[model samples]
Target: MTTLAPTEPLPRFAVFGAGAVGSYYGAMLARAGVPVVLIGRPAHVQAMRAHGLRLQTADFDERIAVHADTDAAAVAGADVVLVCVKSGDTEAAGAALHPHLGPQTAVLSLQNGVDNAERLARVLGRPVVPVVVYVAAGLEGPGHVRHHGRGDLVLAPFPQAARVQAALARAGVPTTVSDAVPQALWTKLVVNCAFNALSAITARPYGWLWAQAGVPEMLRQVVRECVAVAAADGIALDAAALDADVERIAHSMATQMSSTARDLLRGHPTEVDHLNGHVVARAHAHGLQAPVNHALQTLVHLLEQGRGA
Candidate 1:
């Protein structure tokens, strides 16, 4: 893959959150000679500004220079804005950048929830493309990101999608733009709903969770409820295929903690609400009940009650 040459003028890219996902993509883009600026938490911004962003993956570990700031104004001249904040921060992040977003700037939500793009669009008064993120990463430290697994994205087809996909591909970020993004998002959500809560609650990895007795049945029920909700929401999920996919995920990242698990471990609020809670809400909207999902969401809430995000 060929990336933009240093001498070539390319579109400016801005990442709104410097968490693992944001840092990884921004660092990769910068590695490809793209002009990338990052806006996020103070410590991360300070670390990045002082030295550079540290990227650690199984294949490679290196530091790459990329502009970072705590100020939203950093997004002013960006041609593309990547929204990588947690689901709870979608609106706040969008509002923070609203006044600075140029009309031509394309927004992409690389968040967990299925509705983040829709929520961001409403807040920004513009369209925001949804991307199904398939990566396992975490903020190892300030300005440092550890990528544990996959680094690819599945995006919805749009006018600018080809350009974005090409740019990402050249940056060594595998991407696929297709019309089936809605289903793809739900599929990923299903996987999260099945594993995130269990892993987070138990403070264990996928293998540990799936090894427990009765765990398979429990995960199956969660997947069933999620599939029902997805079906109600106009996407018919294939049970067998989804289960197989989840199994593959569990095996592939057997030792990795879920994002929810990492959030809780770090004393930050988890996004179980957007994961299982979304299923509960939509299930209620459709005159259905998702007891398993409701229970998971409630458990996470209880676990996070005295904790601050």
Candidate 2:
């Protein structure tokens, strides 16, 4: 991991997918005077290029100057490229952007899923930072991103991370770099594994989901399975801390249905494979059973297929 001097210039930003999360971050950075380009679908690109990117957040509704393009080549001159595509598209997106990445360019996997950075790294043949996104956002329309609440970043430690952190802080996005980011990612994954599937299956919010009879027991089962898998994978999480973290999600965003639920509702692909599905695979490798996670993944797949049918 390399550290940079405090006085260095901020890197230019490119967002590979100008969807909800990507557009919000790119627009925020662009508003802060960091050059930002967003690559996405043609309609979104044209809409944003013509009318600028519309940001509707809890605090403000503003339009910002961000270059929106459909061309992957737009990432060519960027010093930092954020891979914001859906988890399933990580490899293909990395491949598409590979020819444009310079030796000095830094790529960050800003999408969900714990393994996206590693998957993208395999395709890009470089170290890509894994960013744990703490924001809730949705795309309301073409070129418009509606930010529900919260926008802080927990970044994995990397050679250029501190410099990136400082620049993001200057851009008003709270940034924290941590050596224990894998732990943090697993922590988020555990929460998601417990909540996302139920939210999708029932189309209910966390608070409502938790209040239902048997829901809490189901969550405990899910968490227990996840904890067993994590331990078998050699992660050092204690029981007390894990429960507290799980409780925090119920307390904080209790009204939230996961982005996966929303994705399913909108007919977009959900990231179950990266969430609970990852747990199932890890359990297999560890000689442990993850029946709860396996059931959740299987259930979500069935729901998706039912919707398709």
> What does candidate 2 score on TM?
0.94
Clashing pairs in 1: none
Write down the RMSD of all candidates, one decimal each. 1.8, 2.3
Model 1: per-residue Cα lDDT at residue 241? 89
What is the per-residue lDDT of model 2 for residues 56-100, given as tens digits with 9 covering 90 to 100?
A: 987789988788899999999888898899889998998899999
Clashes of 2: 3
The lDDT, on a scale of 0 to 1, for candidate 1 is 0.88
Q: Give Cα-based local distance difference scores for all models.
A: 0.88, 0.86
Q: Residue 152 of candidate 2: its Cα lDDT? A: 92
Tens digits of per-residue lDDT for model 1, 182-260: 9999998999999998888888999878788988788889989999999999998999888888778778778877889
Model 2 lDDT, residue 150, Cα: 86
